[model samples]
Target: MIKFFRKIRQKLLSENKFSKYLIYAIGEIILVMIGILLALQVNNWNEYRKQGQKEIVNLKAIKNDLQHDLNTEFIPGISYYSKKNKDLSRLRDFYLNKEIIPRDSLLKYFRNNWGEWHIILNKGAFENLKSTGIDIISNDSLRTKISSLYSNGYPEIENRVNIVKQFYDNEFGPILYDNIILYDSTHSHDDFDDLKNRKQIGNRIIQHYYLRTWLFERSELVKSKVELLIGDIDKEIERLDK
Candidate 1:
């Protein structure tokens, strides 16, 4: 094709057909421009396809991370904390209402349930997404929701956990340590010898009840946010599959 065009241009030049040669030259330029444009269009399409594939891969990774959080963190965390709350309620009734529950039973429940519960979110994919640029997600709504889940939702839950932890460490823990005879397997006893002291600490336990309730509600909120995130992930995955 190049040789053919060159021969035509040379023949036109040799015949002193400047007008036709100029027209041929202009046509050649247009063809070259069209070829460049087509090449650019194909390159653009390839880039778009690559980006789409990247988005799908990221979405799948994010889905895996979210599922891990739900299974290994959120769901189990909720259950564990719910049981702790119930145990606390039972102890509260034992103390506040002067319920006739056995001392060993109450102490066992207290020993088992008392501790700081932390929510370890699976934010590996999320952190990577943020570092790589969230715009890669493509879907504006989904991207925003993902961002909110990490930035707002998870942090809110953590803040609640911290609040409860601080109260436990600074107030509740020391009080309980001083007042209650913590059950040890090596030196187990069924006697409620410190019942008077335990009753004295009941006022402090009642004071900390609000923190427990707040933490439980915040855990529920985290679960709700996680569910919403999972739903968005499912929708995005379905979209990608299609």
Candidate 2:
């Protein structure tokens, strides 16, 4: 192609048609410029396409995080807290209302249901987006929503759970060890029926009920938010695929 163009230029120059040669030269320059522009355009398009694909991958990864939490973490958390509340309610019945409940059942509830559900979120993808650039998300509303959920919503729940965990670790756990026989349900504690110890343990169970109730509501809200976000991400993915 270079040789052909060069031959044409030589022929035009040799003919001494200066006006025609000037026109041909100008046209050739325009063609070269056009070629350069087209190449640059194609390169720009390729970059845009790659970035778009990356955005899709990021969205999918985020969706995976949300889905995993919804199914495994949040859903289970909601159920766990609900059960906690119920068991605490049962304990409250016996302690507060003086309901005649069996010793074994009460002990089982106290011993087995005494744990907190720590929040285990998958923030890897979100952190990756932050590391690269959150603007990579493209959608303004989605970017804001996601940032809010991770930075604000998720953290709020985490803080609540941490408080519950701390209560168990620092305060309530020792009380349980002192007032309740955990390993052996049949073995009663020295102060199991003492008025002071009964009130203390009863008050703790009531407080636990409230905390678990709070956590359950929060879990439900976060789960709903995650589901909505997943839907939005699915739409974005479909749009990008197009």
Residue 183, candidate 2: C-alpha displacement in angstroms? 5.1
lDDT against the true structure, each candidate:
0.78, 0.83
Task: Estimate TM-scores for all models.
Answer: 0.82, 0.86
What lDDT is reached at residue 203 by model 2?
A: 82
Q: Write the per-residue lDDT of candidate 2 for residues 1-242, one digit (tens) a residue.
A: 99998988899889988898899899999999999999999999999999999999999889998999888899888888887777778887778876765645667777766667787888998999899899999999999999999999999898888888887777667778876667774634444456224677778777777777887788789889999999999998999899
Candidate 1 — which pairs collide?
A: none
**Candidate 2 regions with alpha-carbon error over 4 angstroms:** 98-105, 183-197
For model 2 the local lDDT of residue 33 reads 100
